[model samples]
Target: MAAGLEARGRTATQVRLRRRFLRFVRVRPGERVLEVGCGTGVVVRDLVGLVGRRGEVVGVDASRLMLGKARTLCRESARRTRLTLRVADGARLPFAAGRFDAALAITVILHVIDPMLVVREMARVTRPGGRVGLQDQDFGVVAVTHPERELTDRILHGVAAHIYPEPHSGRRLPGLLRAAGLEGVRLQTDVFQDTTLEPWTKTFLERRGERAVRFGIVDAATARRWLDGFTHLVAQGAFVLTINYYGAVGTKSR
Candidate 1:
């Protein structure tokens, strides 16, 4: 998981999209920030740069292993910027209320059992007028160029349904922030497009394929066939994959 997080963070598209969302949240130097579910400190590293030397960025994750990896990955950056990592739950952040200028969770709401609780905790830790940002991919609109459309739908849709309570979580961010009593909610939509089947993209597909088989959505043979379809398309220079990411930000009410 650490390797995957690092790989995704290193991807050009991901880096651009992440930093764009941070800017949308209006992160500034010398402000304290908190990131929930900071897997491998990918976004935390970016936040360190955005907050500058005078600012502090605190990261929390439920998994100690991921936090350990984050510390290792973010070691050098911590020297120049105030950075902290802790193993904590999103629904019960270990900080006092109004402790941060901004709080964000990227691609994390979808996996959590209770997103609202987490959002509320994030809001509690953020000062009134500070921003709460949430970003996630809406799997409902993901498009891929594959000859086996039916098979693709079965694997992708079935796996997502089995894994997440809300597969279309990205589109719900604005509503979520509002439900959490945040004001002036705004949304930003971004696309991750891959035409050449980059390594990260391949791993993404492979992981999906693995999940499909484990979930009994497709047999092992069928899963292999489905993945091979992508390779064939890539060889023919016809491969295309696009996923939409939705970023929503809102302010805490005073």
Candidate 2:
């Protein structure tokens, strides 16, 4: 999970989406920005360069281990800009109201039991005129090459429903942001189509394949066949996977 988190932001599709999101927020030099669930700080490294030395970029996560990893990975960027790392919960941020020019929680709310609390906190901490941007993946829409159609659907749906706490958060982000009283809400999507193995597809089968039985999605051996089929396709240079990531932008009412 840690390696995936660190490598995901460096992907071509992710870089494109990050640039678009920075434009969406109208990120300015020296403005304070906050990223919740910062993980290995891939976003932080980008935001730091955008914000420059005068600006502040704070990343908060629930895991000390993640923060430590982020501190290491983001070290150069941190030196180039004002960067801070904190261990904090998504639902309960440790900052005063309107403390940031922009607040972001990417691929985060899905893990929160009370995603509203996190959204509300994001809105509350972002000053009026500041923007709140959120991006998440809806794994329910994952498309992959598999020999068995039924088995493929089962694995995808099972991971989304069982592994992720809020598998539908991508679709629900707009409503959740609006409910938090953020205005001018807009949603955009970027689909990642990969012919090569990357972080997005890394360990995808290993993480959820054997669990076909555990998730009650399919029989055990049947799952193995589906996994093996991917290997066959990869060897033949025919592997492909498409997943959509949704991004929402909103302005905090002044």
Candidate 3:
């Protein structure tokens, strides 16, 4: 999981989208920021650079193992900026109210049991007029090319629905911020596109294929055939996959 996070973070388009979200949230030098569910510290590493030497970035996740990996991964970058890692749940952040200039959860809301609770916690930790940001991929918007369109749709949609309570979580981000009592909400939409079957995308599809079989969405032989379809597309230089990522920011009322 850590390796996959690192790989996705290194992808060219991903880096751009992450930085763009930070900019949208107005993460400036010297501002204190918090990242909820900071898995592998990928976004935290980027936050450190954006916040600069005077600023600090605090990352919190529920998984101790993930935090351990994050610590090791962020060691070098920590020298340039203040970085803190804590084992804490997103729905119940371990911080004082009005502590941060901004709080963000990227690609995290979809997995939570109660996304609104998490967003409300994020708003509570941020100071009045500070920004709360969220970014997530809407599985409903995903598009992938394959000769077996029906099979691809069944696997992709079925796996996502089984894994996430809200497969279309991305589109609800803005409304979440508003419902959390944040004002002046704004949204930014971005896409993750893969045409050559990059390593990260390959792993993504492989995981889906595995889950499809496990969840009884498809049989073993069918899953194998479905995955092989992607390989063939890649070989033919006709592979295409795109997932929409929605980023939203809102200000805490003063």
Q: lDDT per residue, candidate 2, 186-245, as tens digits? A: 998878778876756657666678666787787878777787888888889988998788
Q: Which stretches of candidate 3 lie over 4 Å from their true place?
A: none
Better of 1 and 2 by lDDT: 1
After superposition of all CA atoms, the RMSD between model 1 and the true structure is 0.9
Stretches of candidate 1 above 4 Å error? none
- Which residue pairs overlap in candidate 2's backbone? none
Worst 10 residues of 3 by lDDT: 13-22
Write the residue-wise lDDT of candidate 1 on 5-27 in tens digits. Answer: 89999999999999899989999
Residue clash pairs of candidate 1:
none
Model 3 gets an lDDT of 0.94
Local distance difference test values of all predictions, in order: 0.94, 0.86, 0.94
Pull out the clashing pairs in model 3.
none
196 Cα displacement, candidate 2 (Å): 2.5
